[model samples]
Target: MPRPICSQCQFLIQQCLCDHLSVVKSDIELVIMQHPSEVGHAKNSVRLLPHLLDKVRIVVGETEQDFAQLKAELEAESRPIYLLYPSEQSVEASQVKHSQQGILIVLDGTWRKALKLLKFNPWLLSFQSLHFSPQAPSRYRIRKASRIDSLSSLEAAAFGLQALQPQMDIKPILSAFDAMIEQQLVHMPEHVQARY
Candidate 1:
Protein backbone atom coordinates (compact mmCIF):
# COMPACT_ATOMS: atom_id res chain seq x y z
CA MET A 1 0.00 0.00 0.00
CA PRO A 2 1.06 3.57 -0.58
CA ARG A 3 2.33 5.45 2.45
CA PRO A 4 0.00 7.98 4.04
CA ILE A 5 0.57 11.41 2.52
CA CYS A 6 0.29 14.69 4.34
CA SER A 7 -2.71 16.67 3.09
CA GLN A 8 -0.80 19.93 3.30
CA CYS A 9 2.72 19.24 1.99
CA GLN A 10 1.69 16.10 0.10
CA PHE A 11 4.80 14.39 1.44
CA LEU A 12 4.76 11.01 3.16
CA ILE A 13 3.47 11.38 6.69
CA GLN A 14 6.80 10.39 8.19
CA GLN A 15 8.61 12.97 6.06
CA CYS A 16 5.92 15.62 6.23
CA LEU A 17 7.22 19.15 5.63
CA CYS A 18 4.14 20.95 6.95
CA ASP A 19 5.91 22.16 10.07
CA HIS A 20 8.75 23.74 8.09
CA LEU A 21 6.60 25.68 5.67
CA SER A 22 6.78 29.49 5.86
CA VAL A 23 4.00 31.35 4.15
CA VAL A 24 5.05 34.42 2.16
CA LYS A 25 2.90 36.73 0.14
CA SER A 26 4.28 38.39 -3.01
CA ASP A 27 3.15 41.23 -5.22
CA ILE A 28 4.40 39.52 -8.38
CA GLU A 29 2.49 36.42 -9.44
CA LEU A 30 4.28 33.13 -10.10
CA VAL A 31 3.07 30.45 -12.48
CA ILE A 32 5.00 27.20 -12.31
CA MET A 33 4.55 25.01 -15.35
CA GLN A 34 5.62 21.60 -14.18
CA HIS A 35 6.11 18.62 -16.41
CA PRO A 36 3.84 15.70 -15.42
CA SER A 37 6.87 13.44 -14.94
CA GLU A 38 7.96 15.44 -11.88
CA VAL A 39 4.76 14.84 -9.91
CA GLY A 40 5.99 11.92 -7.78
CA HIS A 41 9.72 12.74 -7.66
CA ALA A 42 10.73 12.93 -3.99
CA LYS A 43 13.28 15.68 -4.60
CA ASN A 44 10.99 17.86 -6.67
CA SER A 45 11.01 21.21 -4.84
CA VAL A 46 8.18 22.51 -6.96
CA ARG A 47 5.89 20.47 -4.76
CA LEU A 48 6.85 22.56 -1.74
CA LEU A 49 6.64 26.02 -3.32
CA PRO A 50 2.88 26.58 -3.37
CA HIS A 51 2.60 25.86 0.35
CA LEU A 52 5.16 28.57 1.11
CA LEU A 53 4.02 31.35 -1.16
CA ASP A 54 0.88 33.28 -1.88
CA LYS A 55 -0.20 34.05 -5.47
CA VAL A 56 1.46 30.95 -6.92
CA ARG A 57 -0.22 28.83 -9.58
CA ILE A 58 1.04 25.34 -10.30
CA VAL A 59 0.09 23.86 -13.66
CA VAL A 60 1.12 20.31 -14.55
CA GLY A 61 1.37 19.52 -18.23
CA GLU A 62 3.56 19.86 -21.37
CA THR A 63 1.03 21.11 -23.85
CA GLU A 64 -0.70 24.37 -24.67
CA GLN A 65 -4.12 22.77 -24.20
CA ASP A 66 -3.11 21.63 -20.73
CA PHE A 67 -2.55 25.26 -19.74
CA ALA A 68 -5.68 26.71 -21.32
CA GLN A 69 -6.95 28.29 -18.13
CA LEU A 70 -3.54 29.80 -17.32
CA LYS A 71 -3.20 31.16 -20.83
CA ALA A 72 -6.63 32.67 -20.60
CA GLU A 73 -5.82 34.25 -17.27
CA LEU A 74 -2.57 35.68 -18.65
CA GLU A 75 -4.46 37.11 -21.57
CA ALA A 76 -7.06 38.66 -19.32
CA GLU A 77 -4.56 40.30 -17.01
CA SER A 78 -3.18 43.72 -17.89
CA ARG A 79 0.26 42.98 -16.43
CA PRO A 80 3.06 41.72 -18.61
CA ILE A 81 3.84 38.00 -18.61
CA TYR A 82 7.47 36.86 -18.57
CA LEU A 83 8.94 33.41 -18.97
CA LEU A 84 11.91 32.58 -16.74
CA TYR A 85 13.82 30.56 -19.29
CA PRO A 86 17.42 31.23 -20.19
CA SER A 87 17.08 31.37 -23.93
CA GLU A 88 19.40 33.42 -26.15
CA GLN A 89 16.70 36.04 -26.42
CA SER A 90 16.11 36.25 -22.69
CA VAL A 91 17.18 39.33 -20.79
CA GLU A 92 18.71 39.02 -17.34
CA ALA A 93 16.11 39.22 -14.57
CA SER A 94 18.04 42.04 -12.89
CA GLN A 95 17.71 44.11 -16.04
CA VAL A 96 13.91 43.74 -16.28
CA LYS A 97 12.13 47.09 -15.94
CA HIS A 98 10.48 47.30 -12.50
CA SER A 99 7.87 49.83 -13.51
CA GLN A 100 5.19 47.27 -14.40
CA GLN A 101 3.62 44.53 -12.33
CA GLY A 102 3.98 41.16 -14.08
CA ILE A 103 3.63 37.43 -14.00
CA LEU A 104 6.69 35.16 -14.07
CA ILE A 105 6.30 31.76 -15.66
CA VAL A 106 8.84 29.15 -14.61
CA LEU A 107 9.16 25.70 -16.16
CA ASP A 108 9.87 23.14 -13.45
CA GLY A 109 11.69 20.22 -14.97
CA THR A 110 15.04 18.90 -16.13
CA TRP A 111 16.72 20.68 -19.04
CA ARG A 112 15.44 18.16 -21.58
CA LYS A 113 11.97 18.07 -20.12
CA ALA A 114 11.86 21.86 -19.94
CA LEU A 115 12.77 22.05 -23.62
CA LYS A 116 10.00 19.58 -24.38
CA LEU A 117 7.58 21.74 -22.42
CA LEU A 118 8.58 24.78 -24.43
CA LYS A 119 8.20 22.83 -27.65
CA PHE A 120 4.70 21.72 -26.72
CA ASN A 121 3.62 25.12 -25.49
CA PRO A 122 4.47 27.39 -28.38
CA TRP A 123 2.28 30.18 -27.05
CA LEU A 124 4.89 30.81 -24.36
CA LEU A 125 7.13 32.09 -27.12
CA SER A 126 5.16 35.29 -27.33
CA PHE A 127 6.08 36.31 -23.80
CA GLN A 128 9.26 38.11 -22.80
CA SER A 129 11.88 35.74 -21.35
CA LEU A 130 14.15 36.42 -18.38
CA HIS A 131 17.24 34.74 -16.95
CA PHE A 132 19.30 35.17 -13.80
CA SER A 133 22.95 34.78 -13.00
CA PRO A 134 23.23 32.79 -9.75
CA GLN A 135 25.63 34.30 -7.26
CA ALA A 136 25.98 30.88 -5.64
CA PRO A 137 25.54 27.30 -6.75
CA SER A 138 22.17 25.60 -6.26
CA ARG A 139 21.44 24.37 -2.74
CA TYR A 140 19.50 21.35 -3.99
CA ARG A 141 21.49 18.58 -2.31
CA ILE A 142 19.32 15.61 -3.14
CA ARG A 143 19.41 15.82 -6.91
CA LYS A 144 22.45 15.95 -9.20
CA ALA A 145 22.46 18.58 -11.89
CA SER A 146 24.55 18.19 -15.02
CA ARG A 147 25.33 21.88 -15.12
CA ILE A 148 26.60 24.18 -12.40
CA ASP A 149 24.29 27.02 -13.41
CA SER A 150 21.17 24.90 -13.15
CA LEU A 151 18.87 25.60 -10.19
CA SER A 152 15.93 23.80 -8.66
CA SER A 153 12.44 25.19 -9.14
CA LEU A 154 12.28 26.68 -5.66
CA GLU A 155 15.66 28.36 -6.03
CA ALA A 156 14.73 29.75 -9.40
CA ALA A 157 11.46 31.10 -8.02
CA ALA A 158 13.16 32.66 -5.01
CA PHE A 159 15.83 34.32 -7.15
CA GLY A 160 13.33 35.45 -9.76
CA LEU A 161 11.03 36.91 -7.11
CA GLN A 162 13.91 38.67 -5.40
CA ALA A 163 14.89 40.29 -8.67
CA LEU A 164 11.33 41.24 -9.58
CA GLN A 165 10.37 42.58 -6.17
CA PRO A 166 13.43 43.83 -4.37
CA GLN A 167 11.41 44.69 -1.25
CA MET A 168 9.96 41.18 -0.88
CA ASP A 169 11.36 39.08 1.97
CA ILE A 170 12.45 35.69 0.58
CA LYS A 171 14.15 34.50 3.73
CA PRO A 172 11.22 32.43 4.92
CA ILE A 173 10.84 30.64 1.62
CA LEU A 174 14.56 29.89 1.44
CA SER A 175 14.58 28.68 5.02
CA ALA A 176 11.80 26.26 4.25
CA PHE A 177 13.71 25.04 1.22
CA ASP A 178 16.79 24.41 3.35
CA ALA A 179 14.68 22.52 5.85
CA MET A 180 13.31 20.26 3.13
CA ILE A 181 16.82 19.54 1.84
CA GLU A 182 17.94 18.67 5.34
CA GLN A 183 15.02 16.30 5.72
CA GLN A 184 15.86 14.58 2.45
CA LEU A 185 19.52 14.29 3.44
CA VAL A 186 18.58 11.94 6.29
CA HIS A 187 17.34 9.37 3.79
CA MET A 188 20.48 9.49 1.66
CA PRO A 189 23.40 7.08 2.02
CA GLU A 190 26.51 8.17 3.91
CA HIS A 191 28.60 8.46 0.75
CA VAL A 192 25.86 10.43 -1.03
CA GLN A 193 25.43 12.81 1.88
CA ALA A 194 29.17 13.35 2.03
CA ARG A 195 29.13 15.06 -1.34
CA TYR A 196 26.87 17.86 -0.14
Candidate 2:
Protein backbone atom coordinates (compact mmCIF):
# COMPACT_ATOMS: atom_id res chain seq x y z
CA MET A 1 0.00 0.00 0.00
CA PRO A 2 1.08 3.56 -0.61
CA ARG A 3 2.30 5.45 2.41
CA PRO A 4 -0.33 7.76 3.83
CA ILE A 5 0.37 11.36 2.88
CA CYS A 6 -0.54 14.47 4.80
CA SER A 7 -3.34 16.26 2.96
CA GLN A 8 -1.85 19.64 3.81
CA CYS A 9 1.90 19.15 3.49
CA GLN A 10 1.66 16.39 0.85
CA PHE A 11 4.50 14.49 2.44
CA LEU A 12 4.41 11.09 4.14
CA ILE A 13 2.68 11.48 7.51
CA GLN A 14 5.90 11.60 9.49
CA GLN A 15 7.72 13.89 7.08
CA CYS A 16 5.07 16.59 6.91
CA LEU A 17 6.69 20.04 6.56
CA CYS A 18 3.77 22.09 7.80
CA ASP A 19 5.47 22.57 11.16
CA HIS A 20 8.71 23.69 9.51
CA LEU A 21 7.03 26.44 7.50
CA SER A 22 7.76 30.10 8.23
CA VAL A 23 5.53 32.88 6.94
CA VAL A 24 6.74 36.04 5.22
CA LYS A 25 4.30 38.76 4.30
CA SER A 26 5.03 40.61 1.05
CA ASP A 27 3.02 43.47 -0.33
CA ILE A 28 3.54 42.26 -3.91
CA GLU A 29 1.16 39.78 -5.53
CA LEU A 30 2.64 36.46 -6.73
CA VAL A 31 1.15 34.03 -9.22
CA ILE A 32 2.82 30.69 -9.86
CA MET A 33 1.86 28.88 -13.05
CA GLN A 34 2.65 25.27 -12.31
CA HIS A 35 2.63 22.45 -14.80
CA PRO A 36 0.22 19.65 -13.84
CA SER A 37 3.07 17.12 -13.43
CA GLU A 38 4.71 19.17 -10.67
CA VAL A 39 1.77 19.15 -8.29
CA GLY A 40 2.91 16.19 -6.16
CA HIS A 41 6.54 15.67 -7.21
CA ALA A 42 8.63 14.93 -4.13
CA LYS A 43 11.36 17.48 -4.86
CA ASN A 44 8.99 20.18 -6.07
CA SER A 45 9.90 23.42 -4.29
CA VAL A 46 6.78 25.30 -5.24
CA ARG A 47 5.10 23.38 -2.43
CA LEU A 48 6.89 25.60 0.07
CA LEU A 49 5.85 28.87 -1.61
CA PRO A 50 2.36 29.33 -0.12
CA HIS A 51 3.88 28.87 3.32
CA LEU A 52 6.45 31.56 2.54
CA LEU A 53 4.40 34.26 0.88
CA ASP A 54 1.39 35.95 2.43
CA LYS A 55 -0.33 36.41 -0.93
CA VAL A 56 0.26 33.75 -3.61
CA ARG A 57 -1.87 32.11 -6.27
CA ILE A 58 -0.87 28.65 -7.52
CA VAL A 59 -2.43 27.91 -10.91
CA VAL A 60 -1.78 24.39 -12.19
CA GLY A 61 -1.90 23.82 -15.94
CA GLU A 62 0.20 23.99 -19.11
CA THR A 63 -2.17 25.06 -21.83
CA GLU A 64 -3.76 28.20 -23.17
CA GLN A 65 -7.28 26.94 -22.45
CA ASP A 66 -6.37 25.98 -18.90
CA PHE A 67 -5.10 29.49 -18.25
CA ALA A 68 -7.82 31.40 -20.10
CA GLN A 69 -9.56 32.66 -16.98
CA LEU A 70 -6.31 33.58 -15.30
CA LYS A 71 -5.29 35.46 -18.43
CA ALA A 72 -8.52 37.40 -18.39
CA GLU A 73 -8.08 38.20 -14.72
CA LEU A 74 -4.55 39.41 -15.36
CA GLU A 75 -5.70 41.51 -18.27
CA ALA A 76 -8.31 43.22 -16.13
CA GLU A 77 -5.91 44.01 -13.31
CA SER A 78 -4.52 47.54 -13.29
CA ARG A 79 -1.29 46.68 -11.47
CA PRO A 80 1.76 45.99 -13.63
CA ILE A 81 2.06 42.28 -14.36
CA TYR A 82 5.57 40.92 -14.85
CA LEU A 83 6.70 37.48 -16.00
CA LEU A 84 9.67 35.89 -14.23
CA TYR A 85 11.25 34.18 -17.21
CA PRO A 86 14.53 34.92 -18.89
CA SER A 87 13.48 35.63 -22.42
CA GLU A 88 15.64 37.50 -24.92
CA GLN A 89 13.60 40.59 -24.05
CA SER A 90 13.65 40.06 -20.29
CA VAL A 91 15.32 42.65 -18.10
CA GLU A 92 17.36 41.91 -14.98
CA ALA A 93 15.15 41.64 -11.89
CA SER A 94 17.19 44.33 -10.14
CA GLN A 95 16.38 46.67 -13.03
CA VAL A 96 12.63 46.46 -12.30
CA LYS A 97 11.14 49.74 -11.06
CA HIS A 98 9.96 49.35 -7.46
CA SER A 99 7.46 52.12 -7.05
CA GLN A 100 4.39 50.09 -6.08
CA GLN A 101 3.21 46.54 -5.46
CA GLY A 102 2.46 44.64 -8.66
CA ILE A 103 1.68 41.15 -9.80
CA LEU A 104 4.66 38.86 -10.42
CA ILE A 105 4.08 35.60 -12.27
CA VAL A 106 6.55 32.74 -12.00
CA LEU A 107 6.65 29.46 -13.89
CA ASP A 108 7.18 26.41 -11.68
CA GLY A 109 8.51 23.51 -13.72
CA THR A 110 11.62 22.01 -15.23
CA TRP A 111 13.32 24.07 -17.93
CA ARG A 112 11.83 21.97 -20.72
CA LYS A 113 8.38 21.98 -19.19
CA ALA A 114 8.64 25.70 -18.47
CA LEU A 115 9.46 26.28 -22.13
CA LYS A 116 6.49 24.12 -23.10
CA LEU A 117 4.27 26.11 -20.78
CA LEU A 118 5.53 29.31 -22.31
CA LYS A 119 4.92 28.03 -25.82
CA PHE A 120 1.45 26.75 -24.96
CA ASN A 121 0.51 29.94 -23.22
CA PRO A 122 1.75 32.56 -25.63
CA TRP A 123 -0.15 35.31 -23.88
CA LEU A 124 2.55 35.16 -21.20
CA LEU A 125 5.00 36.65 -23.69
CA SER A 126 3.13 39.92 -23.83
CA PHE A 127 4.07 40.79 -20.25
CA GLN A 128 7.40 42.33 -19.26
CA SER A 129 9.77 39.46 -18.38
CA LEU A 130 12.17 39.66 -15.43
CA HIS A 131 15.18 37.45 -14.80
CA PHE A 132 17.72 37.38 -11.99
CA SER A 133 21.23 36.09 -11.62
CA PRO A 134 21.26 33.58 -8.76
CA GLN A 135 23.23 35.05 -5.87
CA ALA A 136 24.05 31.52 -4.70
CA PRO A 137 23.89 27.96 -5.96
CA SER A 138 20.75 25.86 -5.58
CA ARG A 139 20.16 23.99 -2.33
CA TYR A 140 17.96 21.59 -4.29
CA ARG A 141 20.32 18.64 -4.16
CA ILE A 142 17.96 15.71 -4.77
CA ARG A 143 17.19 16.73 -8.33
CA LYS A 144 19.72 17.21 -11.09
CA ALA A 145 19.50 20.39 -13.10
CA SER A 146 20.41 20.58 -16.77
CA ARG A 147 21.98 23.98 -16.16
CA ILE A 148 24.34 25.01 -13.38
CA ASP A 149 22.80 28.36 -12.47
CA SER A 150 19.21 27.13 -12.18
CA LEU A 151 17.36 27.74 -8.93
CA SER A 152 14.30 25.89 -7.77
CA SER A 153 10.97 27.69 -8.02
CA LEU A 154 10.99 28.51 -4.31
CA GLU A 155 14.54 29.78 -4.51
CA ALA A 156 13.77 31.74 -7.66
CA ALA A 157 10.74 33.36 -6.04
CA ALA A 158 12.67 34.13 -2.89
CA PHE A 159 15.44 35.80 -4.86
CA GLY A 160 12.98 37.50 -7.17
CA LEU A 161 11.04 38.88 -4.23
CA GLN A 162 14.28 40.00 -2.66
CA ALA A 163 15.18 41.88 -5.83
CA LEU A 164 11.74 43.47 -5.95
CA GLN A 165 11.77 44.35 -2.26
CA PRO A 166 15.27 44.59 -0.88
CA GLN A 167 13.95 44.93 2.70
CA MET A 168 12.51 41.38 2.72
CA ASP A 169 14.48 39.03 4.96
CA ILE A 170 16.10 36.25 2.90
CA LYS A 171 16.24 33.85 5.84
CA PRO A 172 12.52 33.39 6.56
CA ILE A 173 11.79 33.29 2.83
CA LEU A 174 14.10 30.28 2.49
CA SER A 175 13.53 28.52 5.82
CA ALA A 176 11.03 25.99 4.49
CA PHE A 177 13.26 25.16 1.51
CA ASP A 178 16.16 24.47 3.84
CA ALA A 179 13.89 22.40 6.08
CA MET A 180 12.60 20.40 3.13
CA ILE A 181 16.15 19.64 2.05
CA GLU A 182 16.95 18.49 5.57
CA GLN A 183 13.90 16.22 5.60
CA GLN A 184 14.80 14.66 2.24
CA LEU A 185 18.44 14.28 3.20
CA VAL A 186 17.45 12.30 6.30
CA HIS A 187 15.77 9.70 4.10
CA MET A 188 18.72 9.31 1.74
CA PRO A 189 21.34 6.65 2.24
CA GLU A 190 24.51 8.00 3.86
CA HIS A 191 26.56 7.01 0.81
CA VAL A 192 24.15 8.78 -1.51
CA GLN A 193 23.89 11.84 0.75
CA ALA A 194 27.67 12.15 0.70
CA ARG A 195 27.61 12.57 -3.08
CA TYR A 196 25.50 15.71 -2.68
What are the lDDT figures for the candidates, one per model?
Answer: 0.88, 0.87
Which tens-of-lDDT digit does each residue in 102-180 have in candidate 1? 8999999999999999999888999999998999998887789999998999999989988888888988888889888
Candidate 2, poorest ten consecutive residues by summed lDDT:
170-179
Poorly placed runs, candidate 2 (over 4 Å): 190-195
Per-residue alpha-carbon lDDT of candidate 2 for residues 1-196, written as tens digits (9 for 90 to 100): 9999989877788678888777888867889999999998988888777777788999999899999999999999988888999978999988888677898899999999999999999999989999999867898888889999988998888888888888888697677788888888898889989978
Candidate 2, residue 45: how far the Cα is off, in Å: 0.8
RMSD of 1: 1.7
lDDT of 2 at 137: 88
